[model samples]
Target: MFDIQEELKKLPDKPGVYIMKDANGIVIYVGKAVVLKNRVRQYFHQSANHPPKVQAMVAKISEFEYIITDSEVEALMLECNLIKKYKPKYNILLKDDKHYPYIKVTMNEEYPRILKTRRVEKDGAKYFGPYSSGFAVNDAIDTLKKLFPIKTCNRKLPNDIGKFRPCLNYHLKKCLGPCQGEVNKNEYHEMMRKICSFLSGQYDEILNDLKAQMEEAAEQLEFEKAAQIRNKISSMTQLSEKQKVLSTDGQDRDVIGFSRDATDLCIQVFFVRNGRVIGREHYIFEGEGDEEIGYSLSTFIKQFYNNVQFIPSEIVIQNEIEDSETISQWLTEKRGHKVSIRVPVRGELVRLVKMVSQNAEVSLKLFKDRLKRVDNVNEEGINQLMKLLELEQRPRRIEAYDISNTGSSEIVASMVVFIDGKPARQEYRKFKMKSVEQQNDYASMQETLYRRLSRAKKEKEENIEKPKFSDLPDLILVDGGFGHVSAAQQIADEFEYRLVIAGMAKDSRHRTKSLVYNGKEYELSAYMPLLRLITEIQDETHRVAVDYNRTLRAKRYTHSELDEIEGVGETRKKALLKHFKSLAAIKKADIAQLMEVQGINEKVAIKIYNYFRNK
Candidate 1:
């Protein structure tokens, strides 16, 4: 095993890449850093000032590797490229891998159609940005359609001289009347040229032309045409001026960036396609971290581009990164064309970089705020459980099981997953105590826990590469005070997995009074809330097992008043259960609401309404 602190000490302050390898030397995380000394060292520090989530990541890191770069910008560039190549597990990544939209112009035909494209390819087509906001891009498309109305359909016009109607757009003064043979080669070509210039942001000429057209139409007594032209000009001017934000004068390039606070993170990205702010979107991240602004941008860029098919030609960034060459290399290789990255010092581009940095700061702050309570678990209690059970690691999600039986008949087991301080009911499981041969109390507990833990261990071994809730527990909370705890301990010890085994003991009044663990009894009732929580969890688990046993005895059938209605079977029964979760919820569900479930169709809904109405 490699010494982690020694590896941390070897990290240089220069810009570079770092890889976090597990005990097996599997690369779990790969990151680029402008200041290796600061970033790498932060992970090793034992400061209670850190967020619990960050602390958790630090605890899991066993070994690491690094490569120093000359400049921070180089580090940024390299980090993004590496992230794309090796998708790290612990990184603030873009979820739902989608590239921003691009304005694509294809050279596949003499007459090219301008369209919004998600994927960029090598079929002789020029592509613009990967837009973050689909709504904004759609708005741009709507505006373009109103202004120019290029062929919206994917069908190519037959080159056989005269085929197909120009459609409704030709008569509406939308399309250049291309269908009526009214537009000559020169006239139609001129419209495309004007569109090219307008989209490219040389809008001074567009305003001038619209003004001239409005004036000419008004003088010729064409008031409607003049009004139409005037409205188009006004819309164009307002659209250009709306996003008159921080650095609008530069050559069009999408500014993609992300930020995090405590609770959640948001990645704010904008598409500056053809020098216009055409699209923008923000992706919400649920984790917390303390990585610098540049490193975040690099990580996001790599992760974003890894799954997305397109890359812009010029990516201007907040941090001039060290990994610039590598990222550019990877992107160029992907796009089959060269891409460049720059960190400007003085011009509008530099201001744009600063603006992006500011956005990241805002985003990170939001992330931090949300996570302040999410993963703030009771480490002492968890560690105590871990030590008592003799487990390998602290359990993030623990499940405790107990068997309940009415003599030898209604034997069932209840399983619950404790997430942080609360019960994660979604992960709660139940099983019937089958194959136990006899209905002995100790044997029943052993049977139930053995089945649960054995299955969990098998899952952990099978999915050793991936950590999941199926792994063995940190602690097992048996329902009985002492007898159940003793029974559970033996099974865990038999499997050679250290686990904390405890039981919630209740007084004669069914009130939780003490916890029995490893042959000792400790009163827990003094902590009213903790005691109450434990009792509720224990009761819920017991109830769950009893209910499962009842259902198993019932055997593949559930009788409900809802099922008495026509057209209601297992599907509708389950639907009613899911919608309502209980009989009370079903009673509250009105006819109108009941009709909302799909299979209710029409006749069934009416029957359900009357049945409930009469009942």
Candidate 2:
């Protein structure tokens, strides 16, 4: 077993990253510390002063590891990288994984193709945007195409340049007909350069160039070409006039606003590039009602920029953050220039913040109503349960528990959460029944409920980020008869946990039959909505518990013999097993076949080859 105290004693006082792992050796949290010794030791020695979430995390931290970095900035960078790789349970993550649309110019190809895409790759292609709206990006692309007669096809240019005839786009003067060799390389390259300039927001330069082309075409007596150039210039001018100019100083800035209710917080950002508003994006964070605006902004800034490609010169906000200087330095380094974080109290900037805040407020109100409608389907059940059981609250957040085990081995308890009458799957949690080693469902139920509610009480009292079980449930339901309900209620009473406790009883066929509350049984009629909701919760709880137990049992059953091999860690072992799909295939495989698995380099392949051969 790893000695946590001994490891704490040996920690170096340096800037670094610390990874906290649970008893199962799974990384549950990753953080960076300016002073490694002081920061890491706080989790063990002065945990009472830490937040409830941090303390709960500390309780499960059986071991921790650290990597020293040269500076605090480097430590911060490393922390972001590790969080992305491991996706620790306690960290604040970017909820949306959808990539915004960008205008991609295929500069690597002979005849470049301009198209709209969501992915940005490093292949010598020029990308513009990360536009919030796909329609807006498409509109921009369409305008560019009308202005410049560029090819928008998948033809193999230069190889079959003159092999195929021109299409309708060529007849309509929408394309330069590169496939028909109508436009030379130099002329096509010039037009592409102009398109690039236009996409770069150099509208004045593109307009002047178009005017010069129109005059030249007119002098050559090409009235058709002159008319096309004149039309392009007119369209470009109209688009330029449509842009809303907030300032003429050409400063790049981002205006931030905050809004929230009791359950959710919404943050809206207006991306102002070159003094014009380009686009806006809103992000929603759960459970930030009591959080300080400054702290929330700090967390939002870090997580927001973790994946963002563009960093503005200035960020204007309504409140000041605690680590504004550090974040500014980080942003400055990211953008290769100075980046300012300003909290404006007066003047034009304040007005901008107010405008953004109004937008945020509207967005939050609309989003919250939408989310409430999604949960209102179960609202009647929640209300009915509260009234029937004489509960203290509306049972908006109900938690159902079930214990699953196979002959006392790999025993576990699942806590399925339902918030606002709907299942909050992300908030559901599972416990491994630490205290109760045997297959005693009542004892396991008591221990799990006590542990869960105690942590929730601490978190609620301490005003910490109540992640998952840390948030107190309005009602608790255990899967069993009266015995389970009594056990859970006793635990709650002993811990002073403020929650209504009940139990679900099963019929002869092992299906949900009724609710057991306060030593009384309430039958669940098949047609009742309340009964249907409770039945669904009970079934989900049982399935979650059984699935978790099965996973644990399967891991114990597959204790691979390859684990004894030297230099073969869990990653490599899994890689080899995945490639061969079984031990028998691995034993019969050669070095080349072993090397076929990614991350299994030649040296490791030879080691595995030699080990199986020697055996």
Candidate 3:
């Protein structure tokens, strides 16, 4: 019923978010357009000119929707929110969104606690990250804990300050024992302030502050305090001396570089804070093979900054994206300062970009090599598994099932497909557990398997050409023991389908222990390739299931937070979240920014502003 040409006629030439839905009314892709009319019409008008992915997406577009925004930046943010919410199939999905952790300092608390977290909440706390990975974040936190006596405990301070005795951390000199009221509040706060300065690359300022405090303490005859400050100054000065200064200008910049193979692209971002390379991160993603570097890099910039808080004054890339000026303007607004986007073709900046690109190339090559090794191991595992289980044929196609949830609220299941020992990611699917929603894993697994196999059977019977469900897996693995295998068997019996079902059993330490099948347990061998392959599959399925469940839980949590506010519906909530990027951002937003969002007016904006303020 949706006419493409008719909708094209009504399209306005403004910035907006666009949604493309398939025949089943499921959103397959989401994008932002600077000129809605020109952008939307281009797809329908010149379908042949688009890349294959776009062409295929267009071919399946049963309907499309758009929401106008005040600026292209707003559209860009809205597009990210929509893509995250729907997880449109064709969009470039960042699977590791929550994988990178941040070092969060609870500055608002009376006694601040520095911890590692992936979630960023707006509780007046300071967060530094999207670190290389969780390990890196943990390492940073550990180092900070060693360098500074900031509290790592979760005890309620001031109220419970003198209630408990000091713990082992105090004995080890790792903590100042704020819980036992051994440290002055002002002095502890000063330590936290110094830690902030250290994180922000104010090394000289910290040293100067420590030196001044040390001299003051010495003059006052407080030798203990003076000695402590002297030690800190020495440590900080040594750390600064160790840092390799890349530029004398003392400016913050991010060097962006990338390399691509036939199927995947690797991007390396070098974080230069105050001209010193503090850290670097590499990202790997599927590529369209023939994509122009400009488009790919541009899309990356938009999505990368969506979650990052630190926007550098300069972003140097090797190639120019189409909307450099607009992106610069957006970054400037985000950072509340002027931001420059430059494509350095020569000189020092160019060399820096090229260095990052070389790093990216090395990273991509290593990743691909590791992937090749994994594939080989998986192939060998399949062969060994066939021999061990006495199976008739190798499981060239294997399916894995895992159920994950936090208690009973967001029970979900993931089904991942492995073809020839490698992930056939496109064929993987996720299911929300509906039949048994409580903490019953057995019932959840049974329901998920029944639904999946039943649907596969129906599709096989119904479709003759390219029958998607007909190409069933040779083996099915469940993330449980005998109970799950039995459940799968019951479904197989009911459906009159022959299935080779195996359960992955974990040891007391929660490590993959063995394969349980047919009332027999095959103990995992450390040297066996089969064990590693099964562990990999199990880990992957668990990750997928947990991620999906987390997404659902987040959506529910976000809905509950906004749904209670008067005059805010689904559309308005989306608009606010998209425009502000996060609930914390929305909470911090003034009435003007709130009003600038698509569906919000002055009255609603004031209401929202007051709501967060009062809360």
User: What overall lDDT goes with each candidate model?
Assistant: 0.67, 0.80, 0.81
Q: Name the regions of candidate 1 deviating beyond 4 angstroms.
A: 1-27, 30-88, 106-108, 177-180, 242-249, 254-267, 283-288, 292-294, 307-310, 332-339, 361-615
- Candidate 3 stretches greater than 4 Å from native: 1-3, 46-48, 105-113, 119-126, 148-151, 154-162, 171-173, 177-190, 202-245, 331-339, 345-347, 374-615
- Candidate 1, residues 14-101, lDDT tens digits: the string is 8788888776666667766658888888777666455333544566778888877776556655666666666666666666675657
All candidates: CA RMSD in angstroms? 18.5, 28.7, 31.3
Model 2 vs. true fold: TM: 0.54
| Tens digit of per-residue lDDT, candidate 3, span 1-615 | 888888889999999988999999999989888999988888887635765457667889999999999998888778878877898887777665534566788899888888888777777998764466677666656667767877887789889988888889888888999999879998998889888777766677767767898999999999998997787676666655544566767688888999974346788898876677767888887543335678778877877877676778899997889988888988898788999999987778887888899999999889767866654767787888888788998898999999998897898999999998888998889999787858988888889888887778888778767655667789999999999999888988898888899999886546676789889988654225676578678988999999999899888876657777899998999888888888889888899988889989999998898888888
Candidate 2 clash pair list: none
Model 1 CA lDDT for position 116: 80
- Residues 517-573, model 2: lDDT tens digits: 888987654224566577679988999999999999988887787877777888998
Instruction: List the lowest-lDDT window of 10 residues for candidate 2.
Output: 523-532
TM-score of 1: 0.49
